[model samples]
Target: MNRRTVVVGTLVVAGAVLAGGAYLYNANQAEQAVAIANENAAVLIRPNSPIIGPEDARVTIVEFLDPACEACRAFYPVVKSILEESPEDVRLVVRYAPFHDGSEEAVGILEAARAQGLYVPVMEAIFAAQPQWAAHGSPNMDLAWSAAEEVGLDVERARIDMRSPAMVALLNQDLADIEQLQIGQTPTFFINGQPLTEYNFERLDEQVHEALGN
Candidate 1:
């Protein structure tokens, strides 16, 4: 069986044998972990990172996401739902965590779509089509591109932009910070800089509400 069908390596699939218990195990042991040290807080958000929602939002969710990770795909709508309910109060800052095969290509498509102000639509499309392209052990990138195109992405333009130095550098920066922040998992979340203590929809929603003092 493909390891990523349930979970992808964050820290290897060995930890994933039991219904992604490793993620819960790690998150539960962090002693209510802060996502990053205050001194290193600046690393969490960079100007180049993709942002969704108002720039002046009161709460920021920094998510370390791998596009090819099934878990990330599963959580996308939940995150979106929270954002929709509180659009002006929360913003999502996406950080790259390309832990699966062909994820960079997927990220490249996303970054390029961002340039055209099509980030969310393209991303939704990509995630909707993820099963076709992100099938573990037998990935097919063409399906991803097709989905992006269906969302009105200018494929040719995206193709050129994906290889640009700026995109490459941005990706590299995100990866560097991932290591610096000790992020070892896909879909790892930090709300207002405090890492999520556990991987569950209820906890995730609670954290966001708590951040808003709701």
Candidate 2:
């Protein structure tokens, strides 16, 4: 081949090789990102946990939320839908980071529900009927108790457990986790381990695909 033709052929081959290398590097990065996320996101699951979703799921979603936060309440349905749709594949862990004074009481009640193995039911009931009790302007223990009763919890025991040091510690630990993760607001979500700034069904699907090498 003439020099020009040989040079052109070499340039084309080099370009293809470079493009292939770039693709491989990107693929490696996506894999590493997912791995890192999973490692940072693993959290303890309490027995009879109120948290929803599968324990061994491919995607874990951690949410820092406040019981009295209106925005958190608003996001309830969306979270519910995500859980229902991905029951076996998505694990959701809820960490209470009460932004209001009344948040502690609400958090206590939730912790109590965990003790009773009624955590999920109580949380679902509370979110479903949030408009009724959350409007009390503070973490109304009475209202939280009422919601517990509505969810078939042993209201008296729930109330008693809510006052325990263990419950307080649990809430404090949740708060610490939120802080450690640098969560600044209610409804802040971490998917796997990375904070999800633009999370939606589409993005979740895309991330899951990348994670699974699809």
Candidate 3:
């Protein structure tokens, strides 16, 4: 199997393994866990988060995503589809969960890309070439930089900005949120301060609809 695939499978699949325990605990605990999780989710959507779609949309999908996770790359289009389908009603707020090695660096590049007004384009480029740079323990930073460069990002400027105090602080804050929210994996999502309570595309779609009161 491909190393990158293995890496993503390891993290996400392991997370799935824990879901059984979560379910067992939830059965014994009633809605208490979800209530606490919803409270935690409320603290996740920072104003400075990278957002797509209408800022004042009725529904918000806050995703704690890691740049190097293949699952995150896969769900990118699904989230985009949700946005495209309901441009007026929904927005996506991306929170960094840079769990994998080099994932933080990737996020740094994305923050730099955001500064240069290339956030969406660079995100597209990175996910498009995710397997190339996001390999298991050995991320190819060169390819990641090249992806940003391909999108007209000023690479040298980005490199400098990546290490800036603002960017460093941004990463730190998101990481802190991850810990506080008890997020154990990447690509975790909350819709309108409501945890999905289940993991699947159908569940995501349902949650979004529920948030919209539809």
Best by lDDT: 1
Q: After best superposition, candidate 3 residue 200: deviation in angstroms?
A: 1.1
Better model by lDDT, 2 or 3?
3
lDDT of 2 by residue, 101-165 (tens): 67777777788788888887888777656666676454455766788778788877877988987
lDDT of 1 at 181: 83
lDDT of 3 at 15: 52
Q: How high a TM-score does candidate 3 get? A: 0.84
Ten contiguous residues minimizing lDDT sum, candidate 1: 2-11
Give lDDT per model, in order.
0.83, 0.63, 0.80
Prediction 1 global C-alpha lDDT: 0.83
Residues 109-206 of candidate 1: C-alpha lDDT, one tens digit per residue = 99999999999999999888998999887789999999999999999999999999999999999999988887787888889988886786567777
- lDDT value, residue 141 of candidate 1: 97
Per-model TM-score versus the true fold = 0.87, 0.69, 0.84
Span of ten consecutive residues with least summed lDDT in model 3: 21-30
lDDT of 3 by residue, 1-214 (tens): 4323444544464455344433323553426547767677656787678888888899989899988987677667667767877899999999999989889999999999999999999999998888899998999989999988998999999999999998888888898888888887767888887776666555677678778887
**Per lDDT, what order, best first?**
1, 3, 2
Off by over 4 Å in 3: 1-33
RMSD of each: 6.5, 15.4, 6.2
* Global fold similarity of model 1 (TM-score): 0.87
Candidate 1 at 137: error in angstroms? 2.4
Which pairs clash inside model 2?
Answer: 50-119, 50-120, 102-139
